[model samples]
Target: MRGCRYQACRHEPLVVVYEDNVVDRNKKRWRRNNEELPVHLRRPEVVRPSRPLSVDQWNQFAWESSQASLVPCENCGRTFAPDRLEVHQRSCKTPLPGAPRKLALQQVN
Candidate 1:
């Protein structure tokens, strides 16, 4: 006969065993016990807002400040926000310096 692998084991096999059903039943019992507690004694449920309350005022202020600081394009005379001016100017039809005017003149000659 083979001896048990564990020194403390009195059974033929030294492995421990647990039933899944017993563990699941214990978890369900714990949840049911907690749910049965008095309303005031239980922890309050947390509610999260879609947008945070604190950032609203700061965001509004920043928008208004940026709108106030808008600069007009010298070539087109159209007002644009500073960040968008460069992109708009790149495609503007107005004659700006460093365009292909010199190349066109050379082609004509």
Candidate 2:
């Protein structure tokens, strides 16, 4: 079969290992989970608990939270508590190229 250097997986007629590794890992995880569950409850279909974030809901909730402590980072654009911002503004050595600098820099510039 033809092979490419940059391509990680080759569809060769010989041994192909990357696909095998994925299948083997999935099989091992399934076996482990199957062993953990009781014999009577060993059905093909089982529901698992997962946590999913809703961006709109989270954003709305965050905006509604107390306005006193949160300030959007002039460097990173992340919202951090005022105390954290205080330390970050003083010590955050990573420069912000395009964004406006914090209040203290305006006087110097």
Candidate 3:
């Protein structure tokens, strides 16, 4: 006769329980509690740097080389390194050639 073979199969039925919902509920409750607290009492947020902490010297060299191209100033037409372009542009008094002229206000007669 081919009946039940496993020994523990007749024991208490096994049940699977998932704790995902419980964890999510707990997180929501914690966040709500923190939000209710005053700013001074709340924990400070962590700050992270945007760039990598330790860049290799070779990688740094490659990055500088890639960005080393000179950019022409729109006002003076003079080329400056990408990093210095902004500083040069700020002090450049020469206006762009053939640029539209500003209209002068006419005085009342």
Candidate 4:
């Protein structure tokens, strides 16, 4: 077989892991929902079930997030959410040297 590229079986059932040190294939993509995981493993970006915040703090977060979403991409000059920026950047085709990437980013940011 030339360059046999068989990926791991995805149909297999996900297994719950307790130990942090041990490498569990299932837990690599997502942490166990029911049980507590390591500090690093927990995704802090998730807003739901997060710590309580003051009205001011919530308002600031909302405004800042909205502003960030409106910021345009340096390469494409099209606005996209911060999370989608990385994906868009990958597919976006950068123009020739004559086209200014820095200027667009500066104006948007």
Candidate 5:
């Protein structure tokens, strides 16, 4: 298959064209979120955040999140699951100038 001439050329940024009715509705939604209207006239706000959790709850959440997260490798600084990081370490190499070099992380305990 042949590629377009523009494939490798400098391309322009995207232009989005929305219809008039859609634009007007989006404008109204923006205004509603920005300008405060009377409670009766206001759209019922669906509150997303729950009441703050206790200190123990917060600690548990932080611990769980840390354990579940994909942490950056010391050498590549790219994220990997702890189990998968070893596999990446064996093969992760970069030759690009100014790119990061991988290093081993020292364990504290």
Candidate 6:
């Protein structure tokens, strides 16, 4: 029988017997009672889906892709040299309201 994936689950097989039925020993592990439980109930750390981008947003990305290295970040709209572009892309702290945080998240491990 396959054990439960959860570290907390101490679940064991439930043995059921019928009066007129012959035991089907060939059958494997029984299904868990909580198999149909909601995902939130099963896993606590669920990430929500991000909002969908509009057609204009896609067009902007496409336009940016066609541009040369002389182009700057769409968020900051500051032109930078090709060599400096990657570094600037990672560290630029533009004051734009909707712009994503410039700094990447530090990995704990």
Using TM-score as the measure, the top candidate is 4
For candidate 4, give the lDDT of residue 54: 92
Tens digit per residue, CA lDDT, model 4, 1-109: 4343332342232232333335454444434541354342233332422688799988888876566435467676776654466678899898787775655466745
Candidate scoring better on TM-score of 2 and 6: 2
Q: Where is model 2 poorest over a 10-residue stretch in terms of lDDT?
A: 40-49
The model with the greater lDDT, 1 or 5, is 5
What overall lDDT, based on C-alpha atoms, would model 4 receive against the true structure?
0.55
1-109: candidate 1 lDDT, tens digit per residue: 5555544464434232345466567767755754775443233222223465578876776676554445555455565654566678788776577654433224323
| Residue 54 Cα positional deviation in candidate 3, in Å, after optimal superposition | 34
TM-score of 2: 0.27
**Model 5 CA deviation exceeding 4 Å by range:** 1-68, 94-97, 100-109
Q: Which candidate is the best by lDDT?
A: 4
The Cα local distance difference test for each model comes to 0.53, 0.54, 0.51, 0.55, 0.54, 0.42
Clashing pairs in 6: none
- For the record, the alpha-carbon RMSD of candidate 5 to the native fold, in angstroms, is 22.2
Summarize candidate 5's per-residue lDDT along 1-109 as a digit string, tens digits.
Answer: 5477655442332222345467678767756753554332233322222668888987787666554445556566666655566688798775467764544233311
- Tell how far residue 74 is off in model 2, in angstroms: 57
Ranking by TM-score: 4, 5, 2, 1, 3, 6
**Each candidate's TM vs. the true structure?**
0.27, 0.27, 0.26, 0.31, 0.28, 0.23
